[model samples]
Target: MRCLYCHAVIHEEMSWSDLLFKRIEDPFCGICKSGLLEIKKENSCSVCSGKMEGSGTCGDCLIWNEHQMYHDVLHSNRSLYEYNQLLKEMIKRFKYNGDYAVAGCFRKKIIEEVKKLPRQTLLVPVPVSEERLQTRGFNQTEALLVMAGLKFECLLTRKNEEVSQAKKLKHDRHSGENPFKAIQQLNGENILLMDDLYTTGTTIRRAAHILKEAGAGEVRSLTIGR
Candidate 1:
């Protein structure tokens, strides 16, 4: 096999488990794999999974928890990887440049995490605006879930085409009118929002607020990056 990211040959020293049982293997070769940094849950914020200097909440989560409106709107978030330079470049190429094959690099991790969520939890992929969907030729968030072979609901819709979340500053992200609207009334169901990135986490928090107001029981998130 070959590295999914760099297309380099992957050499393996087979262990007995490989012959005896079905064991998942790393998709990328050592050099490429080294570039992907996973967040250590023990040293991360309990709410948003941001890296912590100690064993408590990070400053960003602290601010969100303190906000009267935003507090508890998003129950929690679990990010699989840190937004390192290598992942950034891969995301740029996959999301913006239309290199769909790059999605394979993240498939293993996404599948592993989804399997860990409660069986009854509703999986929802954060929707892109119609304009963005047209421009990009695919909703990247939806594509991530689809590529992982996981089922998700289109529960929310982007109300308008405005500035892309990537272009917005922290203040701008917090100031925007709630762009998401629930497609159907939820009945206190546990929800897990799926997205590609979590910066200040303004995006998912807004989505969670809409879902919570519509009666979702617990609104948490699973993001590929933090």
Candidate 2:
């Protein structure tokens, strides 16, 4: 195969990261990783851009008192992709197939999205329950963060294993009160919360509220897919 940036011939034997990292480490490869790839962004509503802003919930959110529910919250969030078939399959393979090797494929994209934020932003991966952690052996979100060269800390804990958020309706998922609890103080810091998928934004919002109450100066969210 050819290097995506340089068009130089690349060996198939080496994994994606090995090939990309080699090019990144090679000074002569002018078309190094930086310019070879970039994350894609789109213009849409800051909160849930599923439809036109004037159409429905967008306008309601503007005047809603829900904003007060989260302290130290700078802005609501956005996501990269709609939770369609392609994304669903990819996430399934990543989560259940033990395909950690493919994580680097997302590195460039994740870094691109993250670069739009402040450099001092600290990444916080949504925590999984102890039972889930023991079964999966690793949190895919954390792995993605490491692959993206971002610093992350597991600060929140899931109180219970509720129904899979993916299987529930958005309203049903967010209908329940926050289910996460912060065990540590964030202490007036900037944070970029991450998760594998954004089904209802319930988990992320709950985690964000916890951090804000702990004195986070600003809180934003990013997910692999929405």
Candidate 3:
């Protein structure tokens, strides 16, 4: 196989089996598999689906606070992929199909995004309710952070087990009634809020509000898909 990005010839080889019952070399190539790994590009806004012009924040995002009440404290947010067919499928499989291994693919993209920001920023992933955690065995946002080798704390909490926000319409997704509470104080801290996707600004806005109320110095968000 040839690498899509570099067009390198990937050599194949076999490895010994670990099981005691039997042993056989498998047909796989280390170089090709590594090369074929998907690379995520810094594309556009997940919330408004606008083009990102190296500002990290989109033009539509500049007016997000006008529609929402939390503008006074929230600083900005960023996402790596447009929430289109490819991203939707990737998120679905990561969330429901038990394809946890793919989290590393997003991890690479998100880490690149964070690197573009100033160093030493604290990462705060949106918290999943205990009920959902029990069923899913992991929070997809947290998994992405772990894979990215970023530092973060679980300071925010879901107020209740609300309906799957993913299925809601964009306007409904931002309705003010959905509440996120801060269980801990992050006073004077710069934070990077992380999530799986950004359909609307509601969830991140709620989180930014609570973080600012808790004395967070600056609040920005990062997600896998728009």
Candidate 4:
């Protein structure tokens, strides 16, 4: 077998607990799996789940709230992992290299978190531009949700002129018309926005604003990384 991220030969070895409980085999070897960083509660920002120095919200979230960058902003965001080098590489492979299978690495984790969303929460994915969608041949966030057995709606319709969000600079990302619009009214009580990563919170923030304008309430976000 091979490691999903590294593609190294993996000589499968089961732990004593796995043997005793007949646990489903893990695809990764110990070394590779150990590199998959899971964020601990104490280390993350209360609002954005980014790496924080102490208990309160991160400075970015504070500034965003103070300035109403995303009016009717999200209630909060929950992220599962830190955006470390390992995760960056994995995402690059999955997103840029067209290695779609790597998306399954987060399937179990995403499904587990989706179950915790509030009732009547509309699962809305961050849509890509027509240019990106055409090049990639798929919506990465939607694929992640489907593989996790979680359902989501492609509510936001992105403009044809825009490119991948990853390719934009920070300032450019914040200043644009956001390049997205809601296609249908979301009359749900809660909106749970989904994305693969949360960087400056720009993408989700823009989407959240559109969802609110379309009738979503108490918006929140869930991301694989922050």
Candidate 5:
């Protein structure tokens, strides 16, 4: 097989285990794989999986929990990698440059995490505004889930067109009106929001807020980057 990111051939020797049972090879080459900075769970905050000094929630999560509008809106969030330079460039290419095949590099990890969630939990891809979707040619979050071969409910819609999150300042990220609105009413079903990145987490919290208002229970999130 070829590396998903760099398109190099992957050469592997057959082992006894490989002959005895079916084994799925990694879709990335060593060089590309090594560049991925995975966030170890042990050193991360309980709420957002962000790096922290101790075994507790991070300052950002605490502030969100304390805020009246976002209090307890999101139960937790987990991310696969750090927003390092390599990842930033990859995201820029995949998201802005319309390199849809880049989504394949993350398919295995995203599928694995989704499988670990409860069977009853609903997978929800955070929505993009119509204008943004048209400009980008696709919703990056939805593309990630689709490339992973996962089923997700399009339960939310964007209420307004807004500036890109990457260009938004921290205060601007948090201060804007919530742009998400639920497209369907949930019957207290548990939801797991899927997104490509989590910065200050204003986007996830805003989406979670709308999910709660639409009768969802125990909203959590899984992101490709933190």
Candidate 6:
């Protein structure tokens, strides 16, 4: 076998516990596995899934819930991993460097998580504009989900002449309206917006706003990193 990220030779072995119980299927080798920063089940904001003090929702979500500019969008969000250095490199290679095969690293795990959600899930991936589509050739978010066998569509389109979320500063993101517009209306259905990363919560909030305004019943987001 081979390690997925580093492409090093993976020596296969099993411990005594594996013989008695279920065998371990470790995708990453020891060094690569050590770099994976999974999100711990800790006290976090119910809305954004961010680590915070106490059991209550974080102040950031509270501000979003109360802020006039937010338009009462963004119900809740969940993420699988933290935005650690290792994850940053993985995302860069997959997204910017055009390594589509890296999607396999999270395919099974993402599918497993999606299964735990409510049935009849409307998996709507955040869309890229024609300009970006032409530049990147493939959408990074869509690439991660191509194997999930779930019904999905690009409901949101990026506005023309808009700077990407990546280029915007933290304060700049919060000040302006999102650059996405809904292409269709959804009526009283559960929506799970899929994206690659969750940063200052601006993009997801903006996307959720349009989804809610378009009549979605409940809008939640799932991201690979937070």
**Per-prediction TM-score to the true structure, in the order listed:** 0.94, 0.73, 0.72, 0.86, 0.95, 0.87
Name the candidate, 4 or 5, with the larger TM-score value.
5
> Which scores better on lDDT, 1 or 6?
1
Q: Output the number of the lDDT-best candidate.
A: 5
Alpha-carbon shift of residue 4 in model 3 (angstroms): 14
lDDT for each of the candidates? 0.88, 0.65, 0.68, 0.79, 0.90, 0.80
Tens digit of per-residue lDDT, candidate 6, span 84-129: 9999999999888888877767776687678877878788888877
Model 5 Cα lDDT, one tens digit per residue, 33-85: 89989998889999999998768888888889899989999999999999998
How many clashes show up per model?
0, 1, 1, 0, 0, 0
Tens-place lDDT per residue, model 2, 25-109, is 2211243334322223334445543334243345534643255774335355556666666556667777777676445556766
| lDDT of residue 56 for candidate 4 | 79
For model 1, the superposed segments whose C-alpha errors exceed 4 Å read: 19-21
Q: What ranking emerges by TM-score with the best candidate at the front?
A: 5, 1, 6, 4, 2, 3
CA shift at 138, candidate 4, in angstroms?
0.8
Q: What is the full ranking by lDDT, best candidate first?
A: 5, 1, 6, 4, 3, 2
Better of 3 and 5 by TM-score: 5
Give model 1's TM-score versus the native structure: 0.94
Give the CA lDDT, 0 to 100, for residue 36 in model 1. 85
Clashing pairs in 4: none
Relative to the true structure, candidate 3 reaches a TM of: 0.72
**lDDT accuracy of residue 81 in candidate 3:** 58
Give candidate 5 regions above 4 Å deviation: 16-23
Candidate 5 residue 168 C-alpha distance from true site, Å = 0.9
- Give the worst 10-residue stretch by lDDT in candidate 4: 22-31
Please state the error at residue 217 of candidate 6 in Å: 1.0
Those runs of model 4 whose alpha carbons end farther than 4 Å from true positions after fitting are 1-3, 7-27
Poorly placed runs, candidate 6 (over 4 Å): 11-26, 69-72, 147-149
Superposed Cα RMSD, model 5: 1.4
> What's the true lDDT of residue 13 in model 6?
65
Give candidate 3's error at residue 220 in angstroms.
Answer: 0.8
